[model samples]
Target: MARNDVDLLDLSLDELLTTTRTVRKRLDLTRPVPRALITECLEIAVQAPNGSNQQRWNWHVVDEPDLRAEVAEVYRSGMSGHQADPNRATRDIDYSTEEQQRIASSVAYLRDHLHKVPALLIPTVGGRMDEADIFLQASVWGSILPAVWNFMLALRARGLGSAWTTIHLHKEAEMAELLGIDAAKHTQVGLFPIAYTVGTEFGAGARQDLADLIRWNGAG
Candidate 1:
């Protein structure tokens, strides 16, 4: 069978990096995401390295109406506290007046209708690590972080957009029960909403120069 062709390497480093945005209100909530495409993306995700090659990762994709609603409820429930927090800031990233308005509008829309998005992905690990200290926590989470990133990159290359969200995990046990996630067996890492972006052209965001972040063996 002939396979579809596209130059993966041809995508400039900047383009690839810039396009991977944390999609929220810009997600095409009306369009449906086909299962086959999601499977293809996940196939790419598994190629990411796992700690000690354990390969013990699981992904749960929710598309059913009732389930999506349930997940959204969990997400909304978690978001309520943040929304109520007095210390939370509402500054916009875009500098222009119109751009700031647009950003604020998108955020408002997502907050209002997050439950209606097409799909949700909850990635999990097969085993739990003892939380003795920071190192132990890092060792367990380090295993899944790479694979999670690969999943997001694959989604971006395929014209999908997602945002890593742990807010819903605040009520992890409830979410687990609703999704039939075996929390006793697998560790739920985070939740992400997956959908085709309303637009594919995202610009590079502002970042500090490497010199400001990098350090030599000894501080100057």
Candidate 2:
């Protein structure tokens, strides 16, 4: 059996949790992510918190050239909407900072090169949630998100990087068709392009301070 625990005292658990940035342009598209590593990450991921211990995670890992191209096209087709949005075009103006500018430019780079990445992962679950009640919807997604987060964390620990992208979820059915997934039965959670980082020097990104966001009691 795979070990479920990492040695917190030996490993920089806090740093890993904090610095696993949403890697984009920095992902080394040229380097092939080893199949063993991907499997290892998934192994680690499956141990994440789930509802009723029912492990419902399903993965469609696209590594073949032809399928990658098709998936990328499908992802891009959906992305065109965001690309055409007026507000998105002016997002740089909304966040005027060197870091934000770098983020914007890198996002554009990924938009152009997503297909070329060494690996594309589509994480899914057994149930569809479109018409499900709030409880069912939350339970379904809640079971998957922790596993996905664990997968990302495992990848970062192994020097691999991937950005979780929801843009492709807009074309979920199309992607499901291409990947031979029965969309009626399974819900595609998101897309992730997996590759090595050009240089692994991640730092925490800016965020709202805990003090500002946290409240001692219920909403005022």
Q: For each candidate, what TM-score against the reference?
A: 0.83, 0.88
User: On residues 47-153, what C-alpha lDDT tens digit does candidate 2 reach at each position?
Assistant: 99999989987888999988899999998887886667777645557557787778778777888998889999999999988889999999999999999999998
Which pairs clash in model 2? none
Candidate 1: stretches off by over 4 Å: 1-10, 83-107
lDDT for 77 in candidate 1 is 81
lDDT of 2 at 60: 85
All models: lDDT?
0.78, 0.84
Model 2 residue 54 CA deviation (Å) reads: 1.2
Candidate with maximal TM-score: 2
Mark the regions of model 2 whose C-alpha exceeds 4 Å error after superposition. 1-11, 84-100
- Clash statistics: count for each candidate: 0, 0
